[model samples]
Target: MTDIASFRLLQPLSRRALLGSAAAAGALIVLHPFAARAQANQAHLRIMETTDIHVNVMPYDYYADKPNDTMGLARTASIIGAIRAEAGNSMLIDNGDLLQGNPMGDYMAYEKGMKEGDLHPVMKAMNLLGYDAGTLGNHEFNYGLDFMFNVMQGANYPVVCANLTRGQLASDPKNDDLFFKPFIIIEKTIRDGTGAESPVKVGFIGFVPPPIMVWDAKNLEGKAMTRDIVEAARAWIPAMKEAGADIVIALSHSGIDAAAHTDRMENASLHLAGVDGIDAIFTGHQHLVFPGPKTWDGMAGVDPVRGTLMGKPAVMGGFWGSHMGLIDLLLEKDGKSWKIADFTTEARPIYHRNEDRKIVADVASDTRVEDSVKAEHEATLAYVRTPVGKTSAPLYSYFALVADDPSVQIVSNAQTWYIREMLRETEYRDYPILSAAAPFKAGGRGGADYYTDVAAGAIAIKNVADLYLYPNTVQAVLVTGAEVKDWLEMSAGMFNQVEPGASDAALLNADFPSYNYDVIDGVTYRIDLSQPAMFDKEGQRVSDGEGRIIDLMFDGKPIDPEQRFVVATNNYRAGGGGKFPGIAGDKVIFAAPDTNRDVIVRYIIDQGTINPSADGNWSFAPLKDTSVVFSSGPKGRQYVGDIKGVAIEPAGDGADGFALYRVKL
Candidate 1:
């Protein structure tokens, strides 16, 4: 952690009083001249940010299915309080996705609808903390737009989005505002070292990913429209500068996109740096913390890529309020205006990463905040505990991707079935149906108990949440057979290219996130681990790759490029999530209001009894008599009975008692 005193403020205490206090304490006092000089000449602006909160307000991760001490905005509140104590001026902002993720959000949306004047539990908590501004995340529309606006009524702060637009209001005879105020200018007075007061104006502009319109089209259709984020920034930043903002900070809900590994713009911070008049940026949506200052390629004067935008400090606090982003700007008075002199950005985590390799909360949550939402939290627990469906067989994803597994197949089947019905009235009703479902129960970030373990019995609301944690609605996209092959090629990027002779550890990209690994189950194909990934993270082809997808067979026949197929997938993926080729939001033929979890529950109930068996539609290219070693959570231990052509050996504990299985395929 950086020393707090480096960015010192002018002492409000007088020299004589300081001397007297020092004499009273019998201690020698020394003051840095630089602090005094900076205090007299510079104004400091502090920005606090929260992103990807996913409504874990109480420090528990329902998705991890564990009591995580590291996360929760309540934990973040402690850091906010501390930062405020040290700074003369500060602003608190959230970057989006505050609406869903945990049972708290689900309970609120389903069990307790928002009353006319009633406040949302999370918004209520944020209001007490005095948030300056926030933007909408994609998940905000999960419960529907009306619910979002209803909950927003309780917020004390402005909910800003510069790209979203509303239609004309008939009663008002004028169009409602699209997005939010392009920017907000805030004026604050600060005391100097000599007991003099200085006035400063700070401007904030908010941006959300335009893709939300497609991701949540079911809820957003004909209500509002979205524009590209970068394009929107280009149009709005100039207007903010003209509006007399001494410092302009972008509250960007979009993550960075960089094609080159060398360029820092791969993260949103760096990308936003290219925008003019954006003096500082507080970025989120990627759920990553800026390690420290970094500079991007072809950028000069402390590029925002390195935590400084146009030489102004910027920071992205990690998600779930795990860390509070802090940027301290040293400004010099140029005539009547305060110009930035020097600045630095830092993210402080509420829970310190301890020597024991565990994150220990540095401070306790504000009792008042917890007390405010205690009732809602309890109500949510009760709601999630209720049984929603019954399953005759266990719904586990133990062999999901490794073999033809039924857990994922059931999900895929349900999604396709749902889409087919939904499109019955649409123009694309005759399209051949295909469903794309990934192994949500895969043992990765989800710990030992994270896998679905409802064993041939009752499936409760908790089980449903476990099966489908994200609040993604169902969507069907139309794509040709060739595009399907490309989509699978992109999905293959999830795996590390295994060299013929490399060890298992060498066959995985340690940095590659597990969520991006979407296993396409409806198609019969083989993943050639020996081949390099066709596309990179940005969806750019690694080579002039014509066909990374081999055998290209659908139902035991070569796929025709012109043959159109409607692939069923969750809203996230269908709306440019994995950056798969030819699967943009525009290609969507049908959108279902039901989430994948709900569909799964409905399917299980309708079936009465399920075999939970995979029909072996997809498999790996001949393992060539070679053995592959993999690890899975203990919850997967019970479902290892069906893996074929593999020698399964128990290889002791890996991550959180995730039993390692060495299989010779």
Candidate 2:
């Protein structure tokens, strides 16, 4: 992580801070250093972006099966009318990941098949909002090319993607036959000052991360390939300028990173912004907002306060239709070419927290947008509510970080059981089988309310989805005992180092996303918070001598470093999603066709009922007189007595509507 001296690693953007920012969410604050030079030929163009929508057409959480104020295109669409009225000319575009996320997307792909003429709910919603252009995200390929193309057929606007190709890649980007149109120059007429209408060719290019080939290797192994994000941008950008395009805007579905550009780097938006011909950029795929004070505040090459990346106007709309990214540009028509005179960027949120920390919808759902997908929305509700199986215990992820959680436990159990059955007759049957699972809803960016909580008995499809967020298939990897230990060491980065006698030190690393904190079942380990973490938040080994993982054992004995084990995990980890050590594509021995969620459902149904209890396989090592505080949802207070293997008590309230709990070691 970049050095952020003023920012605290303990507490993320608090509810009060979000509330403070909400005040400006309604205002169009110009962050440009100087005012635009007034001229008769000057035109103000507003570019609106909705990225990482993930098929959230309605303001509803399909997993929780409830209406949410923080998400949905309907809520975002409500603001577009007022925003368009505030600008001289406007264009709305989506960055990508619109095809799949919640049960609505799953229902369409699985139960209600998408044919040629059938309009997908998200596309229908965007079409109603009159989106000008869109691009494909990595998740768009989750259901395979055929389903993706069928859904894309419903999009009224042109969808372009520059990087993805049918098969082999050529030496140069231009020589490659792309799967979609590389770029499009939209010929639009903008009314300039003094009532003069002039022609403007605005070029929009799109790029997805190169790792889509690996992430979706099962579906895209021989069918598709990709070029680096910056490579594609470098080749296509100059061509766009050569093709009579005046202002080029990049709809990059990649996040910003200041690290030196490497081959096939996932987060390459910062480097893409440095490309010569690109004028403005809209970025996503990290599910984070740009110009936010918390995350990208002091990162190199990023000016969150000014909403600029590599000195160009840039914005990232938060995921799931939480916010709409806006870039207001002052364009000066100098004879034939148009130049950007001044600009402002903002990510207007759909909701905010009140003074009492209660979420309030800042914008109501646009009824027109909601009515467009009303049928599918109701069908999705019914689909997710379908009974899957039963659970003997209540499953929740509130204390997943500090304990072996049932939410993750059930997934790990299901995966291990499925993998064991699959490998029973295979050569790998001799190897001890373990399973790795993580808490997908442990209240990171989604805030205090974002956690999985299921009551005992009568589990539904939505509850299973709550347990497993991504649509990743199951994979079994052959790893040695040493690699497994190192993997747990990497996961230990989720906790902060504490002094021997420290009091009330923050325990959880707020920057470390909870999804990456893998808990491996069929093994026991202890995390020594007194020692420096062997790996950094980015999964890089920063400490060689000091280690956090201690007393790691498998099958009730000290594991041999050379002993091989079959570890069942999701395709994302097997394909190197979190950069875990010694686990990648080469190590994957078996790739199952079924998704992890499906496996969980099958496991639940086969058993009829499951205990769904955490086995207390891992815990923090003794730290003398040390106490650490961590935050979870306020509802976690009721389950504090159920937490095993750790001593914890209420520490009072926390920021962002979270309740604090002190873990005494």
**Residue range 248-268, candidate 1, lDDT tens digits:** 878887655443223112134
Q: What is the lDDT of candidate 1?
A: 0.67
Candidate 2 residue lDDT tens string, 592-627: 645687678668768988888999999999888889
Collision pairs in model 2: none
Candidate 2 lDDT at 401 equals 93
lDDT for model 2 comes to 0.84
The candidate that achieves the highest lDDT relative to the unseen native structure: 2
* All candidates: TM-score: 0.68, 0.70
Cα misplacement distance, residue 8 of candidate 1 (Å): 21
